[model samples]
Target chain A: MNDSKFPPNTNRVAEHIVGLPKSGIRDFFELVNAMDDVISLGIGEPDFMTPWHIREASIYALENGHTSYTSNLGLLSLRKEICRYVKSNYAVEYDPVSECIVTVGVSEGLDLLLRAIINPGDEIIYHEPCYVSYAPGIQMAHGIPVVVPTYEKNDFALDPADLKKAITPKSKAILLNFPCNPTGATMPLDKLKEVAQIAIDNDILVIADEIYSELTYEGEHISIASLPGMRERTIFLHGFSKAYAMTGYRIAYACGPVDIIDAMMNIHQYSMLCAPINGQEAALEALRNGKTEMMRMKYEYRDRRNVITKRLNEMGLKCFKPVGAFYVFPNITSSGLSSNEFATRLLNEQNVAVVPGGAFGKCGEGFVRCAYAASIDNIVEAMDRIALFLKR
Target chain B: MKNNILRLLRKNARLSVENIAEQVSSDVATVQKIISELEDENVIRGYQAVIDESKLSELQVKAIIEVHIQPQRDGGFDNIARRLANFAEVNSLYLVSGGYDLQLEVQGESLQEVAGFVSSKLATIEGVTATATHFILKKYKEAGRLFEDGAEYERLKVSP
Candidate 1:
């Protein structure tokens, strides 16, 4: 049944889509899944279930006949709740009607934002050793991703100079994910002001992906848009996934200037149409009443962070204590093996799976991203296994 | 600082000092010292697990007895309260202000033991006037844990 008339490459995939590199992490996800006893310290989702109250609300919404696409901008009530939440917490205001659009997740929100704004070859500057989505997301939007590899010595804080160097006439926006993912770094207000000033001076847009805003351990996470003169140019990507432990709900939103959101919503209506109606209801419940459960989970993460950070350091892995997020990126240079080599051996020998830092970005070698979201007993046991592996 | 540690310990007595110190953001030594001082000062009276007796085959009976008592010239209800607390069967005693002067939570190996404790011991107190004992049929929630009508937490052992 071979169609011999057409050549193998007669019809080609889109150049941009074909050029997107396959994620190295997915291979490890599969490899770990095949093994019987492997401990997955590799996943980035929360170990906690979505709170009972949020689940109940979503169930009620379904029973009450909300099983349809919401408005293009999502339910008005949900947008209002999001606006109130940001205004109270970050002290930044947005007109919910004009400035907010509920997207499938930050995953979709980033895609929509990029397609809305980026012309061919428009450059987006982002911090490196970052979330795996940044580069591919930008590529899918037909934008060139300019990566600035932050140093571990600086605790992975974006150096204003490095960010400035990456900017040019072609640079359209700065994409930032603070309280960062793989590195577990957070940008304090002072550091954020420096970047904000640079963005203001350059007249470039700011794309702040503050999805982990609520999980900061030491101090409040400053939304870069909150700084003066920055609000007008900043597009905020935030959601209920990390904070409310609602990752599976696929609920997230974007808030920016009226013009930009309108542009994004134009694409959203044609593609995603609208976020799930029940997810919007659950998100509303999370914003209004999920504070206690959020704090409870945050408390658990903090304990895990402390134990893992201290244990890794004590074991001579030289981990920079992560003040935010649930991951601990520890330098494994002393092991004398490449990050992939170490991760593979650790899995094959000790049955503990950690994502190699190399999976994140080129500059991320000599380390591994160990998510501390597991129970304390597992974390302790994994650390013991790692220590034994190192010894062997 | 000490109060925060005590509060956390109240929620989970199984919490290690290392865990409590991490949450409160104090050094391990400082937390250890504070906890020891609290223990020496008798601020933390004791800790016990809240178990679901129904889950166990070795069943027990629980009863709450309300006692009306005349006030002593010296100790008021405190006198009867302390005397009631000394009994082996009394799990908890509170000087209540409603129709009763004292409320007792009593637990024993069987229904007969609880009944005997109420009739033979608790009623013999000099100031005791009348008694009403109520048997507990079930417990919905205790000390922040839900026994029934609660979802099991089935989070993946580890997730991203």
Candidate 2:
């Protein structure tokens, strides 16, 4: 029995696992890694280390032996802080005891939310060219992903008309990532209001992944859950990764109607158990004291964005100036090559690493996403090399 | 506007007016005009590159001298402080208010030169009384810049 399979078909893994493509940006980055003097604008994280005070808090917690898994709903103090944070900033309220569960990251929160709500063949309508995990999470939960394509001309904002068209009686939820990764598109109040209205009309549950909420540049982040009639129907997800430079800590939370959160906590209790208590302590410190550092990093990113925008446009790359996250989606159609070919060639020739837009989704083909979260000097140098590549 | 511009220039003097304007959310012409006004008013003083002399292959020694002097009939330590400030060897001089009447930071090519300056020039000044010279052993931080050098850190290559 161990030596011989009945046939290859008998030994095959599940069809869904076989069908799903590998998750994001791995191959191109592998080519980047085995190189000398490479400059990567590839990562979607803050270049700065986690702020000192937050790290210090985690260290203090660990020194006091707080290494155990927290309660499935997380430490009450952390949940309380999450409530105060969302209330003060977005005016969205969730009871610490009933309506919030701290998970591994926004990554894990996505998984828990999808698993909690989706039934077999339930449709999840989400925008294309989103963070790499959006579609995969829905698909893994046995939910069919319905793509709504957002264009650069629309500043990557989802059209409500398209949303209405995508919704059906089978549509179970709408997944959104704003100040979104890869695209860096933020929904303004007017546009966000329309999206919220569409969700209400369909009675669709909304999974708002707002991890990058604090990094918003131009204005305060406006949460759809904070909009009229949206609170009860939304599962608000956020994490300490982007804003607090705590990606390594891997703790985030999902807050919503108690029923949905209860379902999520059910899964959380079995599988993930709880987010790390040390990370929760660090995230709590960030919520309490990391504001000034966030502002400083925001200014750095904005400046780097300006430098990249100017330099890329100078080299004939059409960059959509993004006002939210640290990424810039530059149309590399001028290079007369697909974004994949462009990224491969640039990495090979100039030793500069950037993610091809196609890695995000098919709609992202002609563009390349450059994360300006790198140092200004490296950005300048990468631009110089890219300019040289463009010329050649 | 003026104070904001000064604050920015203080942090990074090499920043262009356009960069400062964007940071402060003002326009280029306004930032340029404000900077020009600051220059005229001497609020924006000179700019100098911070250099680590030890890294330049030059052997240098520094000494901080605390000199007590009886006040002149008219001028306090200001006269001697100004005199000490003019010396080419002096890096900085302050009319300090604590136990030390005056503080002088002096740099030289060797300890002998620094010792000679103190014994020959500083000791002969009229009304000069007690003197305590503290030789600096190492430079850790100077002018808000760190001097300790190490390997350039490379971040881990993979992240989402």
Candidate 3:
């Protein structure tokens, strides 16, 4: 074939596709790595390794020659274990065979759902400041992302009134993430009920990302799926990454009505055959026998959460007391700088890393997010540097 | 008299409290107290001098960073968010409800600066699995003010 024989390239990459950038935490780490000495409190991943047993299970799967691709819906054993775990822990039910599909990660599950359900001009109601992908993914799927801005004073809780206001005739779905990422905020059961009622009345689907359901520090983590009439309407996304610290393994699953699951499965079948075979085995093992490890990690996180909350409050940062997640979203508007200005100065001057709130959405401009997944020593050191930086 | 004085002061932030009081027939203490309250409530967030950045010609790059994270066990994302909340470079961070778990706004002088921050700093963290960055092109409207105000169309017409 002649070189340059292919049709001349004309169209730019689809207008909806967005590129992923390096995370702010990664940027901060680069600075830390180059410096003589630095402490970092950025990023929200667990510092602990995947439990030894979970690792061993993956090893066992590999050794037993379970490397081939499993069913598109994922390995039966893992899905069954997920069903048990969800029912026992979250009070939600799913049939492993027909209503669930294994995904590369929650990320992939999100992509699949958006692709499967969204039509051009569909409205996606979501909370903000939210996980970054919801809006962009909606945009890419040719959907409009209507953000319901949660307030820091309200502990980042969603307001039913706001949700009502954001709804329109075109509204297709509402995305909920309890035990949320940056804010570490969880929806109370009553709020979840109210949200469910709203979703039901509006005939909207509820895409609930409960990947962090197991990391709650307060009252029980309530799944929207468990609410009355919500199981039929809500698509639950969960994964072994956060609970098992298996982020690198990229194993997650989604469960909803058969139609939605089938649609998502179509996307999964075309894009990714299945989650890694080893990851599926590891996730199954973790679900079955990792409760103690999960509890231990949760307690350690609680200790770190307490220390950081107290210390930051002492340092003049007004932080909403987080109930479930390990993050603390504080109001930095009082600091006399924009969230971006504060974060940049802190990293450049104090060698500390953090993400600015505005990156989440316009409503998030006044605050910053701090991840305390680091050790006590790193948190303490980073806080001291922050104190000094603030003093200066 | 009071209304007129209030209008005058509203028109000019540089007017001293004493100057406003003199015009309004009020005491300086009263004027000072009102201004103080406004500042405290952040109705007037802060005073700023509009700098001519062209003199320095520094690079102004804005990027949106999407972060995926798992909430820490027991403590959830609170522990992780608080640690990130203190950094200077982070303008804002949000726990969003979609594909990427967290969204962050970062401002830097160059793309390299942002990329460096992401790869060396953010990706290395434990909870963050992947990040996607979107660089802002032109801010058409920010804080409710239109930037170009239909000028681009006019410019294109003239050029063509």
What is each candidate's DockQ, to 2 decimals?
Answer: 0.35, 0.33, 0.01
Which candidate comes out best when scored by TM-score? 1
Locate the minimum summed-lDDT window of 10 residues in model 2 chain A.
A2-11
Q: What is the number of backbone collisions in each predicted candidate, taken in the order shown?
A: 3, 0, 76
Q: Write the per-residue lDDT of candidate 1 for residues B5-25, one digit (tens) a residue.
A: 886788788888876776676
Better of 1 and 3 by lDDT: 1
List model 2 lDDT by residue over A274-352, tens digit each. Answer: 8888999999999889999887777777767777887788789987678788888889999999998999999889989
* RMSD, one per candidate, in order: 3.3, 4.0, 23.9
lDDT of 3 by residue, A232-267 (tens): 999999998877888779999998899999999998
What shift in Å separates residue A97 of candidate 1 from its native position after superposition? 1.6
**B21-134 per-residue lDDT for model 2 (tens digits):** 755657899989888888898877788887777778888999999999888877777787777789899988888788968899998999999999999888888878878999
Q: Candidate 1, A49: how far from true, in Å? A: 2.3
The list of candidate 3 runs beyond 4 A from truth reads A1-11, A18-36, B1-160
TM-score of each: 0.90, 0.86, 0.67
Instruction: Arrange candidates, best lDDT first.
Output: 1, 2, 3
Residue A52, model 3, lDDT: 88
